[model samples]
Each structure stands twice: as C-alpha cells, then as structure tokens.
Target: MKLSALVPLVGVALLTVVLVGGCAATEPTPAAPGGTGDGHGHIEGATEMPEPQLRLVTLDSAGSLTAFDPATEASVSLTDVAGAELLTSDGRYAFAAADARLTIVDTGTWTVPHGDHSHYYLAEPRVVGMIDGGAGAGLGRAASNAALTAVFFPGSGETVVLDGEALGEGEIEELARIEGEPHEGAAVPLGEQVLVSSPDAVQVYSAAGDALGDEQRCEDMRGSGITSVGVVFGCADGALLTVEGEDGVEFERIPYPAGATPAESFANRPGRPDLAAPAGRSGAWLLDTREREWTLIRTEQPLLRAVAVGDSDGRVVAIDALGRIVVLTHEGVQATSEPLLAADLVGAELPAGVVLEVDASRAYVNSPSAGLVHEIDYVDNARLARSLDVEGDASALVEVAR
Candidate 1:
C-alpha cells in the first residue's frame, strides 16, 4: 500500500487505541498545592486565612469562655472554667478567678505602638495555665511593664504576686505571698518589691519574701491604682504614692486638701498617670499621679461606675444611675450616650457593669438582662458603634492583645 493509505490506517489505529485505553484505565486526579478537591471539582482549604484583629473575652453565666472578634463579627466558644470572675487583662493575658484557682488565658493578639501608629499581630488564643489563688480572690491586677501580677484573696488576707511572663508560659511561680488580716488587705507588685496592705500601713516585701523597708503609713488603705509614675493607695487622710528613685524606691504621702472629703478609693487604667473615683454623692475625684495633684469634678448625677481613660486632656468616663454613659473632660461633659441598659437595673445585683479597658480605643459595657455588649468609641464623642448579643449572661468582659 502507498504511504498515504498507510497514514489513514495509522490514524485509525491511534484513535482506536486511545478509546480502548480510556475505558480500561482509571486513575485518581491529583489535588492542588495545599488543597484536596472533591469529585465535583470543589477544592477545600484553598481560601485565605482570617486576619488578626482585636478580640473581646467574655465570661458567661454558664462558666464558659467566649472570644469575639469585632472586626469579623465572629465568636468561638472556649473551654469552661467554673466560678470564674474578677476578669482582668494586661493587654496580652487575661487572669480570671476560678474558685481558689487563677485561670490565665492567652488573648492571642497584641498591638505595639510606634510613635503615632502601631503594629498588630496574632497568636494562638488558649488557656495557658492556672494558679492556686486560695479562697475569695477579689482583685486580679497585672503590671505589664514590670511583668508581674497580683491577686488578692480577701478570705485568706493573702496577696499573691506572680511572674507575669512565667504565668503566661504555663509556669506558676509566686514572687511573694504575704499574709495579713483576712478580708481587709490588698497588694501591688512593683518590680522586685511587692506592696501589701497591713493593719495600719502599706508594707513592702522583696520578691524573695524579705521585708524591704519600714512600712509606709497608710491607715485604712482600701483602693489602689497603678500609673506610669507609680502605684497609689488611697488612705483615710491622703494617698500613698510609690515611685522608683535613683537610690531606691521612694514613697510619698500626698494628703488631700485639709477640709476636702477623703477619697477612700480610686480606679485608673494600668500604667496611666491619672486616677478617678467618686468623691461623694455628686462629685468625682481626679488624681494626677505624675504631679501629685487632686482635682474634684462635680457631676449632676451620682455615678455607679467611673474609670479614668488616661487621655492627654484628663478625660474620665462614668456610668450614671440611669445607665447613661457619660464622657467628661476638663471642660466637662463632652458626650453622653443614651441609656443602653435598663434604668431599673442600675443598683440591682445583676452582673452588669462598664469596663474601660486599658489603652483600648473602645469601651465595652455589658447588659446582663439583655445579653448584649455595647461597644462605645471613646475617642469619638462616645459614639455607640454596635452591640453584640452574646451567649449566656455576659457578666464580665475583657479586651486583650495577643
């Protein structure tokens, strides 16, 4: 046969072979680089991961932990820890009271400020560890710069200070455990020294349990706050301020005006220079830790909860008796949000309160009756940004950066 005729024969043979091979042989299709494909051609695990954002931690009535990301409006249910309360954060870790144990949770996100801007990162959020905090753990405070945390057990009258970094790493080591009269003492961790409340003074102790110096006179010390300048304890007559000096730690008693009503307690953001507390029925006390000055700001209505925001303008935010969120600056009421919670529940035993998170751009107010969390933009006229309806009775909320 001619070559042309042979070409037709070869083509027919090739087509016949391909048709037969297709029917006889079958093999699985390969998957994409990091994904497996279904029979219908849908690929799994091909989508991009979620970006890191600021998150809020809530302790529900059912004793479960919930992490909510405001940016994506997503929430995940974390493990449950019983009897958890007194939630506090150091921007990176959250310390909660779980009966006689202190439960530490990693927020898995953190921000680093650089000049006017900042950088944010994400990590794994988890329950890092726990510490035996004894009974009636009333206060949970963290000192970020000093890498320390103090938990006050009112029932035991013991203040337990722990290594912050170590606690976050799942290692429980007490820097100091000072015992005092039960239900009448408090403690603050100051670098190598721990300031503890005694019967008639604020006592200092080294991390190794040795007394540092003579106790500073602070009769009937009740409330304390940490600022950038130092740690302050409110007394019957004045405030005891502790600062780091060249030679050693320095203590000063900044007495209130001779006739001024004593400020029995105060509240301030961690590492800020300003502290705020209720002066009396209708007045608010502002303490400047850096200048050792006190300014009394009068409010038309009594405040149920007040927190110093530590802004440059000496602004403070307070919730009045009617569930109104009011922002006050030196010039007076900058803005006030409408009643977000039920006015009748103001003085009730409900787990309802406002938490002004440290160095946070927004404030979280929990309404247990409504099962909602109202997010307020503090920098912008105290605007009500949005509300998140969380599961369970949202008793406490804390914002933390990983």
Candidate 2:
C-alpha cells in the first residue's frame, strides 16, 4: 500500500481538495434520504474547516479557470470560458460543457458527508451561471452527497433538476424539468425520485415533478454514475440499479458478463461502490457496486481513462493505449507510466476532455497533449505523484472540494 508522496499541484490552471470540517459535527447534511434538498448540507457564507481543505478545479484549452493547492501550491483564478468542451463535477459544482453550453463554476470548496463526520466549506470562488444544456448533456451530481443535481439531456429528453440547496446558496434553483423520449439517454436523482432513460423503461420522478412509475428495464440507457450502492445506468443489456427504498426508487438489472463489453461510462471515488469502466479493448471494468460483480481488468494497452480507486490496494487507475499510467489490481500489472498521454494518442482517439481524477490519496492524470498534471501515487506503485504545473491545456479536469 505505501503511498504518501503528495506534491503534484504546480502553478495551477485548476485544482480542488477542500476537505475542511473537523469539528462542527452535529450531523445535519442528511435531508435527501428521499431526495430533493433541505440543506445543501449547510452553506450561507461558508467557512468551516478543521480538516479537509484540498482543492483543484482546473479547465483549460482556452477556457481557463483555476483553483489549486495540492498542498500549498496555492492558486486561484476561477473564471473564463469561450468554448469549454466538457468538464463535470458535483463535488461542488464545476460543470463546463461547451456544445449544448453549460457554465456554472463555484469551486469555493465543499465536502458535506454527515454520517459520522464531514462538513468542510471554503467559499469565494465565483461564476455560477449559464445553462442551455440539452443536447447530449448527461450529469448526475452527488459527490459527497449534496442531494438533487441530475442534468441528463440526451440530445433533448431534458431532465435538468438542480437545486442542491440552491446549489449551496449561489443559486440556480429549478428542482424539476422532466420530459422524455429522446433516446441516447440516462438520468438520476433517486432520493425524492427521478430516474429517466426511456426506450425500454426506467422513468420514475418527483423531485417536485412527480411521475414515479417505470421500474427498470434499461435497453439502451447510455452512461450514468452516482454510487454508494445505487444509481448506475448504462444498459445495452446490463446495469440499471437504483437505491433509495422505502417503497420508492429501487431497481436492479446488472446483466452482461457472458459476451460482456458494456461500460460506455462509469468512474468512481465519490461515494464509491467500486466502479471503473472501459472494457472495450479488453481492459478495466471493475464495477463491484457492493458485489453485484463485473471485474475485467485486462489491459495490455488501450484504456484512455479509468478510475475506481476503492483504495486499500483495490486500485485501478488506468490511461493506457500508449498514454501510459496503468496501475491495476485483482492481481495483474502493478505499475507503468512513461508515455503520459503520448501526445494524446491520435490513433484510438482521446479527447472528450480526458480525465482520471480519483482522490482520498492521489491519481490525477490529465496530460492534455503535455501541459502537465500527472500526480499519481496509486498505492505508490503507479507512483509519479507530481507533475502538476498547468497554465494551459490541461484540457478540463475536475477535482472540486474533494
């Protein structure tokens, strides 16, 4: 295991850590057990630290926007965008997409996880505005559980539903917008209800919109995330699983293991239930979701991005296919890194704002054609834990208040 090198956060183009909270623990950030918003876990001005204060919110390729501090690499700029190109976050709002246009930024910092402890806050990062989203959009926020975020456009089936306590007081409020039938879809917010993804059924709602019916069939429901043992949707033939059950949102499909090959997307580290996708070229596809099972791992090369750092050495942080940074587990390939995006590997294609992000220890990887941001220490075997220096082209990485 041995990992603690931590010093990869250079001049910064973007970064986020913000753990903060170590004292005020009365446990109040729990309203969305049914899901909507009753407290974005607490945010009125923000400034309550004692522990986690690590932040990094980068986004470049000309859309600038910083916020560093991998541990005193101190940085801050936070605003700028002209054609963003995809960057999403729920660890405290970062969303930067650029085609269907979505700009919100507010990395003031956050962490709200009130089960036994966790409250962190740090306010003063601005720019929370913009949203035309509906042409492929696809979000599903809840990094640390700050309820009610889901975006999901799917070229316009529309499911916007924000209002995680009015985005923690910066405001965007729209607790529901629901609509369906547009295909290429997927949605999630399963607490007060909201599942969406209809062409085989998945629908279910009521974050203040009400509809709660369809109970999981998933035939083509594109990708989706949010985990802690629930809300996963990526079905062409498998994976539907929702959670909040008290006679409400509860589905489960999981299929696909025979011919396998179905993980268009899914990452982890946020309320992880062990998920890491990209099993196409025969590589990483962990997906444990509390043992629903699906462990592929393969990787000889051909990955581009994989996360799932359910640490303690279950690590699975890939980026192979010549871009190097491959550190898997389940007993195979322990470390490798030297290509570092090997000039963004043009052959298999790699740009959708490539990311690798994971945190709780380290694993940032985002070279953007060599602008810098490696920082991997995946149990020290994937080692390199430093290389941050980004002034431009980190392309779009999200780490917000992790």
Candidate 3:
C-alpha cells in the first residue's frame, strides 16, 4: 500500500517501491559472481553490483536487524542483536551494541570509489560476529576506513580495532585492543595505527598495541570521521584534523570562533572532507576539512538533527524542532518541508532513534511513530521523495552501499 504522505499545502508526487511482502524478511538472493568485476579491481568474496544502490539497515526496539533496498524495495533479514541499543555503520559494515557486547554485521552491499568513478558490490548479508568485552564494548560511536574498523567503549576505556578485510570474510578478528582510563572518547582506524582519543588527548597506537609519538591535546574530544584527506575529531573548543601523508601524521586544530558552542558530534557522507552537526537548537555547524575552516549555518527554528550533504550547492539538510525537514545553503534557509513529525517531536523529550541520514542525492529520516523511513530530496525543495517500510520498526537506522 502506497500511503499518502502527510504533507500539508505541498503536493508531493509519491512513488511506492514494490515490496516482496509487507514485513517478514527471511533470505536474500544467494551470492553469485556478479559481472561488476569487469573493469574495476576485484573484491574476493563480493560480487560487484551494477551500480550504487542505497540500502537502509535498521535495528528495531526488539533487536531485529534488517536491510531494506530502496531500488528493489526488498527487505532482507541479516540477524538479530540481543539487547541492541545502538547502531553505527561505515558504509559496508554496521556495528551494533548492547551494554557489554559489540556486534558487527555485513550488509553484503558496498561501494568503492575509483578515481572519479566508483564500483558497487552485493553479497548475501549476514552477521559477522560479536566483540565481547568490558561493561559497554561499543557504547561510543564506531569509525572505519578502507582497512580497519575501530570500536570504542567509553565506559570501559577500551578501543578494539578489527581488520576490514577480515570482516569481509565474516570474521571477528581483533587487530588490537588499546586500554585507557575510562572517559568519553573516540577511536579512529587510520592507516596502520588506531587513533585513540582520551578525555583531552588523541594518541596513536599500532596493531601490536604499542603507543606511538605525537599525542594531540583536544579538550572533551568525542566524535571522529575518516575522510579522503584525513581523520576529523570533534573537540570542546573546535575540531581537530589529522592527516597521515608521505611525511607523517600531522594535526591541525580548527578552533571555533569566540563564544561559539562547539558541536557535540559530527556526521556527513562518508569519505567526504566536509562534515555537519547540530549546534544548539537553532544553528548547524559545517566544518570544511579541506580548507580547515568552520562555518555555522543558522536557522530560525530549533533543529534536532543536521547532516552536511557536501554537494556542489553546499546543501545542508536538517530537521527542525517542529518536525519539518529544512534545507539550508550558504545564503541560509533555502526551503522547508511540511511538519512531518510534529506529533513525534511535540513531547518534552525527543524519542531515542530518529535521525537524519544523507547520501549523494537524498536524505532519509526514520519515524518510529510511523514505522516508515521518509526520503527527502533536499535539492528539490525538501520534497518527500518517498516513504519506505522495512521489516522492523526502524528505531535505529543507517544507510550503506554508498
């Protein structure tokens, strides 16, 4: 059933993706040698998909993890994570966690950018394995790159690094586990070392669990993102960019302007230089990692979630306090959508899992109240591109496969 989008005043051209069924997702197509290996370098276990297709992976309140393909409108059950409370992904793999364990899942869908072009792949999605340890193994957000995936547990002050290639083979091999004093922090997998962020300093560690030199001091460091140029970590006063080049690892801190509220975390399209985050209630922060500068885009209404699209138009998609999806440009507010989640956000406290997720072309916001993921075309007047229903409630959502 293609339900009408609750958009007032604006007429939306709604299109429904044909579902294999309504909710029950069991199996996916078996893995085969896809011809996608034609021109690009080959990946051992994966079949190259024809082109890049966005897949939304969701972890419901009950711990059911399912992958929903927007193009085929097919939902496939990957696995169930017991007591799963959080879900974070690095394009190909999703790290889900309960208080004491961190689980890694392979969505079987991925993309690799080759120069200006890119290669896509699809396999049978399944659970890789779990990282069992301390009180909260992966409570902190996880970050990854082409080679490694780092999971940090602030409660235990432990950072675990997993080989990306091993993950592709459905393994939970731990490359290293570095220990630190318990504090809110982040760990990013860069080149051959894992950058572990303590409460105030970021240090580099090798796979053999040895600390390297050149520790960076950033007060209240939390979030981290891996871009094409380097790794970015959010700090109390500003943002820190760490680049590993021919010379060595270099750190550059972009301090926020005086009296500015620093971002609690940052998010954007993976592998991009620019990142975005929510600043207070009425502003969004954009950090241009390339130029090493920060730009704050202010909005009139309160914002709950913000993501930098990093497009040619400098488009920034954000969700306002009133449940409207607003699009912002360099000049300011470019457009706004109708109050889609007004009831969901009208309460005194925001719900647990609703978030704004963006890709190359569109942004998606999951409404647990509606059990559907609304696709927003930020470049097109914040139009309701479409709404998709996955297997679970979509309490927690992440986009993969480019």
Candidate 4:
C-alpha cells in the first residue's frame, strides 16, 4: 500500500492536513477473472497496516533536544535549553526541564485509541513555548487528568505548576507558586487541587495558591509518578497513594513490609499503575497501586534505576552499577541484557546517567557513556534488537508512540 505524503499547510502554526496515508481517491484497476489480483484489487486475508510504531526523544548533555523517527531515519532538532535533564511526556506534549526553565515541545504526533487498535497522525513538530521556572528548576512531571505540568526547584524550595490550556494557547499560566523548605520535592495536579511537598507531608493547594485540605504525612518525599489508578508519592515509611473518590480525594499509605528499608523515591511506567524503586542494597520494590500491594524482589546486582512495566505480574527493568540491564518479576530475574553501558567511570561521572524507555514489547536503554541506545525485545527473552548510535551523550530518553 502507498502512504500519502504529509503536506504542511502554509501560514499555519505547526498544523498539517490530517489525512490517512492510503485513503486518497484513486481508480481501482480491473482484476483478472477467477484469480486474486496482486496489486490492483483487494487481496484475501489482508489486515490494516501498522503505522510507524515509535519515536525516540533524546536530551543531550548540552541540553539540546532532538526527536528521532526511526521508521524514516529522520531526526528533528527541537531546541537548545541549558542544563536540561528530566523529560516527561503525557503521550502528547514533551516537557523538558532545564536549570530554570521548562521547555515545551509539540511532538506533532498523537494516537487515538480504539477498542482493539489505534490511529496515528503526524504534523509539523515545533518548540511550542518555554516557561521561566526561576532558579534551580528541575524535577519535571505532567498529569493528564487536570492538564497540568509541574517543575520543582529543590535549591529554591519552589514549585511551579502550569495549566495545559494556557500552554496550548502559547501562554504560561502559573497554577500555583508553592514555597516550602529546600528539599527534594515533587508536585502533582489533581483537577483544581495541586499537591506540593512539605517538610513532613504533602500539602494540597488550589490552583490559585490557597491551601486546601490538611497536609498528608509523608516524610522525606522525593520521587513521584502518575498512573491510571491515581497519583503516587514515595516517602520514608512507604508510598502515599491518592485516588479520586466519590466525596473527594482519598489517601492511603501502603507501608513497606516490617523491617523493610524505606525507599525515598519511585518511578512508574508512563501509563501503568505499578511503581518500582530500589528497596535496599540489593532489593527491588514493586508497588501495585490498583491492588494496594507491595512486593520486594531480591536482585543479585545493586540497582541504580528501576522502572515497573507490564500489568499484573508486571516486570521491573533496572540498571545496576555494573551497567547491566536486569528484568525481574515478582518471582525472580526473568531476563538479563549484556552490559550495554560502560561499568567504569567513578563518582558523579560514573555512567550513572541511564534511562529506560519501554513499551509493550520492547525496552530502549540509553547509556550516555557509550553514546548508544540498545533496543531490547523484552518479550523474546530480552533479545537485543539494535544498538543505535545516537552520536551524543544523552542525559534523558523518552519513547513517543504515534
């Protein structure tokens, strides 16, 4: 089947005509009698072709962001923002946090979900806007429920949350400017309420900065991620799971097992409800928000980063100090990848910069030390597919599907 060419409309703000590739009007060629046509007519057992499956967004050490389309082997440089690191996406827009600014890039692609399949579209991608997050801007996160994006500055003890509508309209509207003690803090948007980190708890505030409900106890909160079930925050004792209830918001603390060392941070798959973190010296923790269960899986290697993927019986993809990728489930180690990153390098320079981007079937591991991204087919026993030389030191990597 022939795909249609993307034609950009003139005088439009990064807009393109949305057209299906093979849906153009054309005359049907005559088919041979009593025989199936090769290319002129409908063939038996034909299925809808899959669109370009994924795109990789990389933030280089220099803070330049580039979106690479592997299907077309095309790369688009979005912007150069200094000190950029954390990259988060809501499957629509990419929010990259630099030193004191939040750069928003329009991915120019999105997916519309159907029951069994999804439709993909693409347009002219561009750097939509940039928000001055003030000094020490870092930890970036996005929430789809309230169409909000947040950036927290640990050095300044300030958190900035922006409304999605304002962003789409090329305006930066601060939903909340929260000030608190200087510590590793995080924020999450829940409709009209914003959750900001306090010294000993998580405090809720209105978009207009008015205090909402009483602060929820969560000592030394650090990492956070949103899932379909709710918003979760990792604390000293355990994790705080918040969900929308009939009355309002319901909060529950899923304590770590007795005597289990507390994990101060957590990371979850973009849309999954399960979260993973480093439990102890050699243990990986999994928290299922939907089930309200926490499971500790022991690992032989000391893990540096762990991301929970898959549904029930989900797996945790972690990178150890030796730069090896380990896939573990609740049972045990499921699969392991060869050391794709350099194990040497010391102190802060250690190839400590590693990011895992995973989808249903594959996981993309980026190693800045090697300047390469190893694509692994997770379902096929963690078989390495391709080691793509991205040709730069990537501090962050995120997978975008269209």
lDDT of each: 0.67, 0.72, 0.77, 0.68
Q: How well does candidate 2 match the true structure in TM-score terms?
A: 0.33
Model 4 ranges with Cα > 4 A deviation: 1-53, 111-121, 136-146, 343-352
Residues 131-246 of candidate 2: C-alpha lDDT, one tens digit per residue: 77655654322222446777765666677777665565567887777777666666667665667777666778787767867556776666778777787888887787788788
* Candidate that beats the other on TM-score, 2 or 3, i.e. the better one: 3
Candidate 4, residue 395: how far the Cα is off, in Å: 3.1
Report the error of model 2 at residue 105, Å: 16
Which prediction has more favorable TM-score, 1 or 3?
Answer: 3
Range of the 10 consecutive residues with the lowest summed lDDT in candidate 1: 1-10
Candidate 3 segments whose C-alpha is farther than 4 A from its true place = 1-45, 136-140, 346-349
Tens digit of per-residue lDDT, candidate 1, span 1-402 = 111111111111112222222353654323323222111110111111233356778787677888888777788876687877667666667777765676777666655443454445455577777767555645444444335666666666777777654553446777777777765566777766777877568888776667888888887777877787888888888889998788667899888877777775566654478998877666678888888988877778766667788878888877766677888877777888887765326363224334545345677777767777788887788898888877677778777652
* Candidate No. with top TM-score: 3
lDDT of 4: 0.68
Candidate 1 RMSD to the real structure: 16.2
The lDDT-based order of candidates, best leading, equals 3, 2, 4, 1
lDDT of 3 by residue, 1-402 (tens): 212212111111121222324433644443433332223222344555567867999889999988888888988888888899888888888878888688888887788788887877766678888887675544655777766778888788888888765666677778888888788778887877788988899998886678888788988886777666788888888988888977667788899999888787678877677788888875788888888888889998867777888876677888888889999877889999998877677473347578778888888988887788899888889999898887778888999987
Candidate 1 regions with alpha-carbon error over 4 angstroms: 1-53, 111-121, 135-145, 343-354, 358-360
